[model samples]
Target: MASLSVGVACVLLVLCMVVPSLAAVYTVGDTSGWTTGIDYSTWTEGKTFKVGDTLVFKYPTFHTVDEVSSSDYSTCTVGNAIRSDNSGSTTVTLKAAGTHYFICGVVGHCGNGMKLAVKVESSSSTTATTTTTNPDFSYSSSNRSSFAAYFITWVALIVILVINVSLWQEF
Candidate 1:
């Protein structure tokens, strides 16, 4: 019984340490999905994106997710796109800490408000703050904890509580 308890504790400790480092997967535009006429700027509001995070763009075949330079994104141009995807679903992994711009490549779609600019921070960053920019609005928010971090904190607290309870019962 003691050996089993120790094994469980060891496994939980490893999971607690590993889970917080796991990346967050965000579905862009949420339930509405990636589409024109949606407020992409507001969608990014109050969200802090860290490196290693994943952004999944789900949209119809009619739309294309085109990654472009800051200048191209501002102008809604796609001929110089850094990356382009027209499939029904597109998954983008944030590899570094910087602002990434994406827009619909279809004519007038981007102009109709199908553009998103997400600012990513290094995972090691202490402060959580992100700024999402668009042609019409620029938003910056701070101090939000990642889901993984929060989940691990709760798990650790529960484990501590259980261990203390077990010890008290023994007394």
Candidate 2:
């Protein structure tokens, strides 16, 4: 039985090492880079942005990346930019679970609709949650389904192994 326990431990160790914590990297505007005449809203449609994911902006020297507030974004006001970058290539990570806005700082560029808005969700939100009106006790948060599956599987295997060992000893 010691060997069986060791084998189970080895399998668990391998699973822990193999299951990668993956994060997606999106190239903004696809092949067009972060420039004018690109429909950023359409590009991000049907896509779910999560924390840890990155947005890569590739543009020329004439254009600049400015992370601005929603009000500034709607009014094309780059003066209140939270973060500004002029490099040809820029990568911004979604560190928090909230909305992020980006726009070009060039005159009349943002007004010409050169902007992007992304809603970043928590990485732990793998399974979708549904709303419930039960006031007694409601579960509206994300359930750790992946971890629960792994734990249940491990417990079942251990139970099966224990039962098999008991039968073997009886013989």
Query: What's each prediction's clash count?
Result: 0, 0
> Which TM-score value belongs to model 2?
0.64
- Candidate 1 has what TM-score? 0.73
Task: Give RMSD to native, each candidate.
Answer: 8.6, 11.4
Best by lDDT: 1
Residue-level lDDT for 131 in candidate 2: 22
lDDT of 1 at 107: 86
Clash pairs (backbone) in predicted model 2: none
Segments of candidate 2 deviating more than 4 angstroms: 1-20, 126-171
Candidate 1 residue spans exceeding 4 A from truth: 126-171
TM of each candidate vs. truth: 0.73, 0.64
List, residue by residue over 18-134, the lDDT tens digit for candidate 2. Answer: 444556768789899999998899999989987766788888978988888778888999778777878777777777677788899998999988999887777795642332111
| lDDT value, residue 69 of candidate 2 | 79
Candidate 1 backbone overlaps, count? 0
Worst 10 residues of 2 by lDDT: 131-140
For 46-76, candidate 1 gives per-residue lDDT tens digits of 9988877778888899998888888888988
